[model samples]
Target: MNVATARLGARALNRALLSRQYLLRRLDLPEREVVEHLVGMHAQIPVGPYIGLWSRLAGYRPDRLSTMVTNRELVRTALMRSTIHLVTPDDCMTLRPLVQQVLDRDLYTNSSHAAVVKGLDLDEVVAAGLALLDEQPRTPADLGRALHERWPDRKPDTLAYAVRNLSALVQIPPRGTWGGTSRTIHASATTWLDRPVDPAPSVETMIRRYLAAFGPASVNDVQAWCGLTKLNEVVGRIRSSLRVYLDDNGKELFDVPEGELPDADAPAPPRYLPEFDNVLLSHANRERIIPDGLSFAEWCRRYGLMMTVRGGVLRGNLLIGGLLNGIWRIDKEKKSYTLVVEPFTKVSKKDLTALEKDGHALLEFAFPKAESRAVQVLPSR
Candidate 1:
């Protein structure tokens, strides 16, 4: 196969991500299919995947996603970075085992829990935890208490963490289901989905899937998303089969041979992204979405200053014309709903008008039952 060497700057990278992630326009696809394609959205925050889907899928209904979760078609599990992600059941089965090392790294390498878990019989812990969860879904506290009784010598927290990190424990509904109370109930991915985990997981396939969704990325970028390192060998092994590029800084970037690159000057519209959306979290270098010199953690800390409402804890982000220009929040009253946009930099008068128009539309989507809707813009900080 002929390989193309395209030099992709931030805009080419930005447009590639927008097109691949279906952010440029809503795609008429099932929620499950979209979830699989993106390899899953960052779903640690409940209601995040719904808002994420709303942003990318045409005519998306919360009920469609809720039903997918309720019916066991898609699952909320610790896959990438050992964080909860909403993924199709098939992807969960394959993706979980591939990233098992990421979870293991938390237990073995991290100092916080390393000594506690050391010398502990991890196999027994996994078996015991799985047996308990097989009997019924369990909260971490409940599972920990049960394990404590069995291994009274060890801390319950350690045992619980071992079980969660070792075994493929998926959070079951009403956890991720839309418009439902989220409880911390866990079950074995094997038992809940009634499928055995893949014996051999392919790193190459995982990287390919990632590129199709979030690429023209570097080795570090893929590592950042999956939380595993030492992929220089894996990336090198597949080098010949992939198209390569260089970032403006001369960093090497890789994408699947078939990946699409939109024009660097393509027009991108305003998009409302939920807190912890993959666009912000997936890349090792987030300069395409986040402004340089500002870390994501620092940005969130500053955003907390503007947070006024008490609702879901995740802060939503605003994407205007392909760059992350601001942050936003949704406040609902008994009779009305308000969408507030707080831009990080000055938005043009024309752009502000366009933003408010989309904000009102988002308000309707977010609070369909409210009799009144309003959009407000705070002065740029």
Candidate 2:
């Protein structure tokens, strides 16, 4: 297949991603449909997906997602990149089998647990863990202690880690629900979802879905998103069916033929995104959303805030006009809620006004019954 010689600049690429992500405008779709469309959402942080969906969907409610969890319509599991994601039951079954190798690789190479589990019979350990989980969903510590009784020589947590890597376990509900305070609990996906892992999961189908949601992307981008390697061959097999383009850096990008590329000057409203949103983390190259030559630490420094290691990783990013501009967080005190924003660069009064307006709306959505709410945009140093 001949690759299209068209080139997409950063702004164009950013808009395409925003359009596909439903970030360009809030959609009035069903929550399950949106979840399935994005494939799944990054859900390492429990409230992250709720905030994410709230930003993308019109009239989104926290309880709707919580209800999905309770109904087993959606589950939180370790899938892409071996991090917990909120995905549909069908996707959990289909995608887990494809990424099993990534999980296994982590199991063996992980410095924390590898040595202790190196010579142990992993299959036996997995069976034991499953048996325990079958009886009831368990926390890692509880499961670990139970398995430790069977394998007295190894650390209990390592045995549990083996099961975590080898088996498809879903973090059960109330655990991932919005405002949920439950301890993390796990149960076997097969039993919990009442369905077997897809015996024949399709990497090509997965690739196609990636393109539909986040494409005009390179082979490296796909690997970065899914944590799978050597997909050049699979991409090669399906190249003829895809539309291709060159990014400004001359990297090859592939997309479904019908994928929309909005005008580079498209208007993008300011959005508040939760930490670990896939839109920020999915691509090998993030310059499309994160502006080039903008140092996040320096940006925070200019705003009189010291960026900590944890702060660096767990940031709620602010987007304006299709690019990252600031970081934000909601603070609670007594019966009040505050949305605090720190911009990376000095902004116009107009942008600040827009940000403040959206910030108040977000606060209302996140903490509806707070006695009071406020939006604070810290000044640049």
Best by lDDT: 2
Per-residue alpha-carbon lDDT of candidate 2 for residues 70-133, written as tens digits (9 for 90 to 100): 8999999999988999999999999999999899888889999889987898889999999999
Runs of candidate 2 with Cα error greater than 4 angstroms are 293-315
| Residue 182 Cα positional deviation in candidate 1, in Å, after optimal superposition | 2.2
Tens-digit per-residue lDDT, 43-99, candidate 1: 888889998999998777798889989999999999888899999888888998899
| Stretches of model 1 off by over 4 angstroms after superposition | 1-4, 109-112, 301-314
Global CA lDDT computed for model 1: 0.84
Over the full model, what C-alpha lDDT does candidate 2 score relative to the true structure?
Answer: 0.86
For residue 22, what is the lDDT in candidate 2?
A: 95
lDDT of 1 at 88: 84
Model 2 residue pairs with clashes: none
Alpha carbon lDDT at 138, candidate 1: 94
lDDT of each: 0.84, 0.86
